[model samples]
Target: PEQAEVREIPAYIIRLQDEDIVAYSRVCPKGCRYLNYIPEPRKCSHCNTQRGRDLCCCGFAVDNPVLKCPKCWSIFDLARKGQILCGRAPRPPVEFKLDLDGESIVIASLQERIW
Candidate 1:
């Protein structure tokens, strides 16, 4: 049987939400096209210690709603398999970052801001 042509969507555009919690796609500091969003503060996957929580595309801590993964360099989604191909080889493992800033702030109010 012929394989069906699958349409591809930007992983960074994926929306992850929970009861009162939501996350958007934040650009990877590494400059990868992939972005991630979590509901709390987290360390960067590349730097392993750098925090990009609630930061904007400028990489600053603001009332931003988009966040990205530090490792796989992917925007955490129900579709992510924890393994992403960058150029050719797979990327290293890393934790995801979340955006939490204020109350009723869909840009940050991810239930509770993670530092």
Candidate 2:
């Protein structure tokens, strides 16, 4: 008689709620929740606690890092008012000159420098 051997399988952490399957990286640990930073890291990575309310003051480190104000250290919420009031106006179109050397032959000329 031959003995049965046990096979090892990869373990996965999954949650089933209302027929919805949510999967998380098991690498962190047995228990952990995703921390939403919104404009940045809103909670401590280890504790997963809400550090502070959204004051549009404390800059988040997750999204649009360049949009943070260095002086105040907060996320730039330009969309709060329903529109952005910053940015330069559009520039005027440039005009070009062309020279026809011969029949069916076209030559284009552009300005080299602006004075």
Candidate 3:
């Protein structure tokens, strides 16, 4: 589905092609650092030889969007909801159930979270 991002909410929002919207928490479970929505990892010349866990091949696989932890280098798949798509580090940013009301998206409930 085509991805259209809407930042009206404080969280990461992805507007689907089907007119449905989904949101995810932006807190990193590893170190409680704020997570950012990265559409794709920037592949630079030096990223290939980087020794620290900053960037890697899995970071390149993020085609749509993924939540990335700046501290522990953890990555969470938006589609998988708190599950580590590549690296294992999720304080378990949960999926909040939303209720759409015209132009507003309301938080209906929160998904059960786990570390």
Q: Write the per-residue lDDT of candidate 2 for residues 3-102, one digit (tens) a residue.
A: 3232231112122223322221111111222211222323423234345333333333432211222223323221221011122212111112333354
Task: Please report the candidate that would top lDDT against the real structure.
Answer: 3
TM-score of each: 0.22, 0.17, 0.66
Report the C-alpha displacement of residue 56, candidate 2, in angstroms. 36
Model 1 clash pairs are 36-67, 36-68, 38-98, 45-70, 71-94
Give the Å error, residue 103, model 3: 2.5
Q: What TM-score does model 1 achieve against the real structure?
A: 0.22
Q: Rank the candidates by TM-score, best first.
A: 3, 1, 2
Clashes of 1: 5
Ranking by lDDT: 3, 1, 2
| Best candidate according to TM-score | 3
lDDT of 1 at 81: 28
Residue pairs in steric clash, candidate 3?
A: 29-91
Error of 3 at 45 (Å): 9.1
lDDT of 1: 0.34
State residue 75's C-alpha deviation in candidate 2, in Å.
34
The weakest ten consecutive residues by lDDT in model 2 span: 81-90
Error at 55, model 2, angstroms? 35
Candidate 3: which stretches are off by over 4 Å? 1-10, 16-20, 42-54, 57-60, 88-91
